[model samples]
Target: MSATPPPYHQTAVRPDWRDLPDGLREAVGGRLGASVVAARTATAGFTGGFAAVLTTATGARVFVKAADLARQRHLADWYARELAVLARLPADLPVPRPHWALDAAGWYAVGLDAVDGRTPRLPWDPAELDAVLAGYAGVAAALADPPAGLTALGLPRLADLARSDILWWEEVAAGREPVPPLIPPARDRLPELVALESRLPGYAAAAPGLAHGDLRVDNVLLDPAGRAWFCDWNWLCHGPAWFDLAGLLITGYADGAGLDAVFAAHPAAVDAPPDALDVTLAALAGYYLTAAGPPATADPASGAGTVGPGAGPAGGNPAGTSALLGAHRRFSGEQALRWLAARQGWH
Candidate 1:
């Protein structure tokens, strides 16, 4: 079987067993009532911190993750949000079950049911895609309305991204940010592009139910039973149910899966808002175009690396820069934008 690149790339640094703060580990132990026998480190996630499945004294397994808020405050905070989101998800949802969480002295960690599975590799497995779509269908069914505490928890709305997340293309077009030569053709049509994207918030705001705001390959795991479980609930939101499906379509497009072919078989994509695929693709294009082809202020990870510093509201790049990271974002963004344009008939 040929392997395509992973749907998302995680090249950020992660700490090993020796690197976690003493309090965080102790807190995990205290909550589980098990002595930490070994830390099986994980390297797939992008947050670039500590993530592992802990083996307890009694041979019990619990998934545990911790991040340094002081160094990467936003990512750490997002990890904290996962604890909150996990606590309230329905029992049947295909996600890790949350056991406990800890936030002491700025270091945060959470323990979850260790899932026995693997993130699916690319070239799109039919069985795996079918399983994941079924999982998404379940999520859509369960979250047709937001759960009781989810709204009160104050999760972000997709409309909130209009100014912040979707306007990137416009910003770079106007020369506010430096432009990179490797960009989408849509940038040249800024007014039209901006107007097209501006319409998304209304569509997004009118979304029927809660959405997994970030749904990509890296954030998913396929179990031995061929079931799919979505990870990383930090970007959870109240939005259109089909949003994740749209992202998947775009991902398919990027991976040479034949966008129409992916959509024809995906029931959720078939049932989503008529214009959602185009709009969501546009939104993705706008978001990625900003980082991929800009004056390098920060690195944006399309599926490989991330802006870490220059990509979001979190702040600027503190770690200086990495050419490899930038190249990944730029390339991923370029492809995503192009795909969006084709979907929109902008070409």
Candidate 2:
């Protein structure tokens, strides 16, 4: 049998913008103008960084994101890289227009033209889901072969990243902290995952493509016209095309029959080669389990005793957290269990 999963603290922590460097304000004002009409917090449940909506005197609106420099430098680099990627994409693609990026002092900021839209409620209609998926697929098709000289968003390849992610889960499972029910199964599934990894390279070699590594419902923006635009390219990288489709299927769509319909709709399009599906499923499992498990005090960005069980003033929304955990349980629990059972040589 697999070892007991590690104990974890699941909490939401909001970063204080008051401590943000003055240079960030100066940079924002300099680029957009000194007339800062209004500033307000935008979203509620992100764990990586803080976000705000800034309105200038001229009525121009921009979304500013302040990421933790001490905790994740790669994320900062991704902000810069995303700007370049947006620049490379055809102007017509349904993506936010990145205005400018600021990397001053120890903080990093990215300003993008705020799209007028909102996140649709979960259990979306069939047409809505199809539209979102189609939009994403179109974007991928457009950038089928990335332009030359474009730097990757500093994200590791899928195979390598998957392996590292598994090890991280393993470490968390073996840690002193309490492991949530969702994680033990993920830990147990490592061997088959390892076996799948060995066979992925060959399939990946067939069609090397670009993917928006994180394509959950939250990252997608639906405008008043029902158009969908993707944001948050921090985890962007080159990998199997199916990786992106799998991410959406596993996280955004429902499980069981709903999931079967999604695959049925896009026969060859969503059918990943051999173990590619497993790798993607395994990665998704690890992401939610780790994201839901707990906060690490040592992690200044997400792990500081700011959010999770027994969180302080800046902790996350309990209702939202409960909803997220519930969704993860619905779609990912079986995969997590299968992963765990595989470790024990269970058929």
Candidate 3:
């Protein structure tokens, strides 16, 4: 097995609620009432945008997350989409409940019910996986049919997403980028690999329901009782239920957890073709790699390393890079490539 890459840190830089423009803060305060006196920033996300918990003088609290479209044009769209999705999600889903939206002072912000929870422990605790999987089942059932409001949101389908993120082998083969050291096998077989990747766009299954387009470990939180609540509604979409299931399973995969065991227990896998899993994993890899910088320029051990800017004051925008963020991207991409490699035998 290849050595483990660095774990993804919750390095998202969020402004303290008070740091926001006075007008915006006043608007939020007026909406929630001026009783709010304490605000603390959370370093758990990678958005690097505006996110923090606001506590009222009376002890009421709300998790406020926002973005400055001027600096984060992409995040603005995501924030808008999140407001749309959260407003219409089924009542039974475990997402944080939205209280209000604030589009003021050159910002897009939303106040939500602050979840009292922690991220799932790494190394795939079986119990936690069980709870999250069960939550997926409920979500699948509640969303068996797309909500009337979502059908018009124009969310991308699975194949649509894959098309947006073509394989890295294609990039390297075309001289657009160099291959990373993590997947040396691809360098010599670019043609074969690229040809095989052509099948991805057509493998998208019919929309099973709503899909959490960006489901990953960091986006999920575990409550005190062990139930799971998925955060980050910015990437919600209408697609096969199994897409998010595959993502959650992939998180476990990176930790050396047995994906087969977990997949066997999910109803989403029922009657699903084996190739379905392959397609999801491939698309995920594509997404991660696309956000990363050029592949490793030298041996990682020699300290010729790259990093993602992470979610610093620059915000956790994908366009930024820090040594740590880069490793996380590479690590995630490597896991994805490994998962895909296991599915197909090379020529």
TM-scores of the candidates in the order shown: 0.84, 0.71, 0.84
Greater-lDDT candidate between 2 and 3 = 3
Superposition TM-score, candidate 1 onto the true structure: 0.84
User: Which portions of model 2 miss their true places by more than 4 Å?
Assistant: 1-19, 68-74, 103-106, 149-155, 166-198, 255-257, 267-271, 290-347
lDDT of 1 by residue, 1-347 (tens): 11123234444456886777787777778787889898877756545667888898999999887767687676667777888898898878889988877786578777888988887765467677778778888887888778888788888888886566655655656767655454445646666665666677888787768888877666788889888888988888877766677665444333555765666556555556666666676666667545544434433343333355336422344452333444444544555567667666675
lDDT of 1 at 60: 92
lDDT of 2 by residue, 1-347 (tens): 22222211222234445546777667668877766677766543434465677888888889887665776565566677777777666678898888887777677888887888766445556677777877877787765676553443344565565544422334444563344454444445555544544554455445566667666666777888888888776666666667677666544444243554464455335546555566556545544544444433253333333223223212343422223332332244344445334434555
Ten-residue stretch with the least lDDT total in model 3: 308-317
After superposition, the stretches of candidate 3 with alpha carbons farther than 4 Å from their true spots are 1-9, 166-168, 184-196, 252-256, 294-323, 343-347
List candidate 1 stretches off by more than 4 Å.
Answer: 1-10, 104-106, 183-187, 252-256, 264-267, 270-272, 293-306, 313-315, 318-328, 344-347
Considering summed lDDT, which 10 consecutive residues are worst modelled in model 2?
A: 2-11
lDDT of 3 by residue, 1-347 (tens): 23354544454445677677987887888888766788877766555578778888778899987778687666767777787888888888899988988788898788888988877766677788788888778877777688888667877675665555544456656866555554754445556556545565554545566677777777888889998998887777656677678777665453456575566568877745667676666655654554565656565434343433322111232542223455556567667767667656532
